[model samples]
Target chain A: MDPDPTIAAIARWSGIAPPNEAARIGLADNAALITEIEAMRGTMGFEEEPSDFKAALRDCREPTP
Target chain B: MNAPVAVTDLASLSMTEAADAFATGEVAATALVEACLARIDAHDAVVNSVIRLDREAALEAAAAADAARAAGRPLGKLAGVPMMHKDMYYRAGRVSSCGSKIRRDFIPGVTATVLERLDAAGAIDMGTLNMAEFAQNPTGHNAHFGHCHNPWDPAYCTGGSSSGSGAGVAARFFYAALGSDTGGSIRLPATLCGVTGLKGTQTRVSRAGVMPLSFSCDNVGPLVRTARDAARFMAVTAGHDPRDPTSAREPVPDYEAALTGDIRGLRIAVCETFFLDGADAPVVAAFEAALDALRARGAVVTRISASSMRAINAYTAMVSRVEGAAIHANWMREHPGDYAIHLSARLFGGYAFPAHLYVEALSRRGPLLRQFVAEALTGHDIVATPTLKTRVPTLAETDIDADPANWSRFMAVSANTRPFNYLGLPTISIPCGFDDRGLPIGLQLAGRPFAEATVLKAADAFQRETGWHCKAPAL
Candidate 1:
């Protein structure tokens, strides 16, 4: 359940280490958030790409003359 | 040859009123600028809303505007209006500290497109206002320039990132200010400070030359006195910009003209779900009253179910944080110590999120948007909610930097507003009523994507029926 090691490892990979204990706590919370978001991935389709967001906005717009 | 308008009366005029007054030669631009300067000089110390006061440059611009009027030259829509902006909007060769210590002296070579548009509209830029550091935190807590105090009650928090823009507008220091909303930055302050704020659909406004927090979610908008003022501000600033290719090509309608104050048959949906969870009694009372007023204005209100909000909220945080982390990766590597402790910590966590998860969050955005629209706006012209789920908290209670334990209250300040950012919809916040503590409360209205006109029309109609927006702080 300790996210410190993973966070530290990722920090090293990203070229920035956690600056303090508060950062580690924040990272732990982020880890929880990521888990929650990942669980929702089942609702997404394999065909969808990040760029589809803009098209979605356009499609949902209220049509004007 | 007419007598000059009194400084107090000029300072109190809304942006649209000032513009109209100037157009008809009822007041000179110099007098308007001077009125704003006098208010800032007298009250800004208590509000702590101003970061820089460009008194000389503003007067020069005002004089030019007055001269143009005397010559009977053409004028822009917002001609002769005086305003300030959140310090993150860049002006060529002028310092835009972005409410951070690291960029305390960073000046950009290019002016923000919104500033250029505001200038072309003949609005005088008085100066820049305070904000959350790098426009990150939701609560108006800045360890660098000092937290922006609510004009209603200095002890209360001005919901931020757009802190000073909200406070300054409320205190009548200026008529309007540009505030960027990544995740409720503009709406939070608008609600907390009792002003009007609008965030068009994502990409509705250009971001070129402005500081970036989350590339996908960041929005450029205005904080003003009433929805009518917001409509005018948007008419000036919302449109495509060549410099910002991401800016939407959607035609910018005459937002002010759309404010006919006739909203008969407007279908407004109210979700009795996540947006209202754990709502404060006072907040609920004020929100219900606002709904009653809107109902009195011939708008149809319906209760709807929204089950996609939790996922929407989570994905929004993921995408914004990851993008923000990527933007600040270099600085975090070289000078993490330069940031406030809480900001640096938040950025540090951003670097830890897995890349796949980031992609997953973005990938789901389209599906989520479609679902939300179908569920919330399929039969509705607008979705209505209380801008904040709880009563306004004081600075002492929400300052996470002082005590990390304050994080929950701090984060909750933005809970109701953040989902709209992820939805990428056009949304607005207007003063609804005051809490038992005499602080302002707000009602948020959202509409279909690219429907800024619809949103403003509804808000303007509500303002006509109710006088909440007219009641200013005693500052």
Candidate 2:
């Protein structure tokens, strides 16, 4: 995970040429959030839809407003 | 019955009170508008809350409302009430800067459906309020519009991206302001500025023409002086809008009618774990006192463990960050320099999220939400917590761009409030007490999905028993 092209490289490919220093630090700081995302792996059941609309609206007592 | 309002009391009259006075012929709409404008003129320089002040137009609208009343023509529920919204809500042909330099001159061809509803209810649009650039930050620091200072004490942060909305309402600049929340924008600001804010169930209000940061989590609501004001505002603004396909088709209940102020048998759940972890002494003290007040009102409060909250908070950020990054991808490519450095840096992280991870996070949202509701809200009518875990920080202390060390402090501003955005539950923040530094503290009450009436009922009951919501900044 440490050896691949950095977030900076991926961003450059996506055409967002932010300052190199800020980009590196920003991506590094985001590692924590990514780790949290990684923890969610294998947690979802296939029947569970990903959309918040589906989740939020499910079993909501009100008929859709 | 609403109390009779005098012209002199217009400056501090709650939204519902002002509206009632306008309807009863006790005060003219012109007088209320003038009182609000006078307050803005006197105190706005320090608060820096308003982005624009539509003086002539507001007066013209108020005069029309008065003319309608004089002629005994039909009037909307909010006849003659004045309000401003976060700069993001679009009004056709009007410049909605959205608190960003890139959109400073960009005008939309269509109006936000919420604005049309407010207009139909006879709310006078005073102007736009300041916010975090692109509604990205939790702290109300806007690099584009000067940082909106807290009305209580200008040195402290007002908590944002709805900074101006909270501060404007606290300063009594206007009765209330519309604020959109993705990651605690409305509640954070409301708590910090000592006002009331509500984020209804996701898609509970139409998002059409309002700026979007995270498509999944964005919620449009209000920051006002009292919960009843929020109730009236919600009743007018909420409902299915065909213009926004995602808008809930559920019927919009009379939120005001639910505020009967008798919470004798209400059940409040207190997750005493993640929400209170590392909370400051003053915050905990205020929260405990608020709980005691509720118990005195006959609410049965129960403490329980919500160990899943840590995970809930973690994934909430992931979803918003990914969506925000996607929304600004094109602009980041074209006009990257136009964004504030810190905001750009935050958005830059969004680009790094893998599509698979984003989908995983999104997919898990449903299961995780069910887990939370089942665990936290089974027999509970409302879950209460401090809106923010710490005392309000100074603007300088939370300026992440100025010093990256401030990142933790800046992030904590929304820690307790963001989970509801993910859960998509109806939630509200109301002033309960003040901290050591005298900044206001908020008691957040989150209800079940689409249970806004229950949320407002609890909040309005609290207001009836306490005078916190009536307190305003000396400024």
Candidate 3:
């Protein structure tokens, strides 16, 4: 079993750069991050290449009409 | 009743008084500047708070502000009001250490957007205050430059990345100081050190020229003596900066005007769950007292379940770890030797995690925010809680090198406030009262997105009704 693959998976999905190779196991890369991303309740798997970017709203002041 | 050299608590002294004294053949900017510099000279050695100082440059700026007043051309809102920028903000020709040794000696030729505005307002920069390396840790401890000690109790921690900003203001070294809030950097310090600090909603203030922590979570604000002072500083710094790609095009509102009203009819939320759960006694008591006082003062207060906060950890776990890792990826790969052992190891391990977790974390955030907005704040104006569960932890307790529980305690106290950063809300941590040990515990007042005015008004009213902000460290 490749611990490195699991380590890479946690960093890719969770975004917290784990401390080192070993820390990816628990330290900064805890169990919550180790769980499969799609395993969470209703998340569709990667094969379902969903369309749009989860666009966040940016506040912009448009001139009054 | 006034001592001859009473260190003027810049929060207590009206800017007008300082300016008047300076102009009316009474006080000199050099005198005030020297006193502040003297503060850095005497106390900072023990506090170990200042990361960078330009003594010669500060003196020259003070003299210039004094001489400009003599020239009679009107100066800015904070004319001759000595101020310092948090180390995250780049000041050209100054080493703006983001508390990371990687850029420890790297000086910039460009000034941070907010620092430039503060300078334009005639505020003199004294130095760059210390923060957690990479603005990651909530504790004020920096392994490289040493930790920033709490002024209230030098043995304890001053909540961090903006730890020095909080400590500097609470110790009354400068009139005002700038800080960044990502995962509650500004507010944690304010709460720990007993000062007023603000965290603007996303893009409410410019982030240009400041080092990045979590791009989506980052905001620039102030730690000052009063919310009014924070507002005054925000008014000058919140305008659109062409240098910032994400900066809002909105006109900056007069935040000072937001402070003039009483919070008599405002609908404030008293959190029932996350903020209230697993709590410390004195902090809860002080927070309740503050809430009761607000109620007595005619503000309508209701206890609401803060389910939104539950999602905070998930959001933070998703965004910051990723962004923080991204910012340091190149550095982590190349000069891994530069990072403090704990931080480098932490970031390295964080980067090793699956990318899917990050995307899933992001996916969770949208729904989490929606639930929070619906359940916690339908018609509410703001949410309030003790800024931290407990008072400042002693260095013996919070030192990463000491006991493992210390680092755990440091992370636990910061958990309650990180949710607000994830949602990108404006929050102010104001000193409600001191603990039995005479150390300060803060009450965090957070409002809806773009509700900076409401939050400032509520904080200003609380300050008006209390004297906590008026108290300064004896040191």
**Interface RMSD list for the candidates:** 2.0, 3.1, 6.6
Considering DockQ, which of the candidate structures 1 and 2 is the better prediction for this target?
A: 1
lDDT of each: 0.89, 0.88, 0.74
DockQ of 3: 0.21
lDDT of 3 by residue, A1-65 (tens): 33656555644554434443434323543555345333443533332333211123222111122
TM-score of chain B of each: 0.98, 0.99, 0.93
Question: What is the DockQ for all candidates, taken in turn?
Answer: 0.60, 0.40, 0.21
Model 1 ranges off by over 4 Å: A1-3, A31-35, A38-41, A44-51, A63-65, B1-8
Docking class of 1: medium
Candidate No. with top lDDT:
1
Per-residue lDDT over B208-236 for candidate 1, one digit per residue giving the tens place of the 0 to 100 score = 99999998889999999988888888988
Query: Which pairs, if any, clash in model 1?
Result: none
TM-score of 1: 0.96
How well is each residue in B1-475 modelled by candidate 2, as lDDT tens digits?
A: 4777644668899888988989999988999999999999999999999998999999999999999999999999999999999999999999999999999998999999999999999999999999999999998998888999999999999999999999999998889899999989999999999999999998899999999999989999999999999999999999899999999888888888888988988999999878999999999999999998888888999998876786777778778988998899888888888888788888887777767657766776776777788788887889999999999999999887787667767777888988888888899999999998899999999988889999999998899889999898897
In model 3, state the lDDT of residue B259: 73
Model 3 CA lDDT for position B22:
60
> Could you arrange the candidates by TM-score from highest to lowest?
1, 2, 3
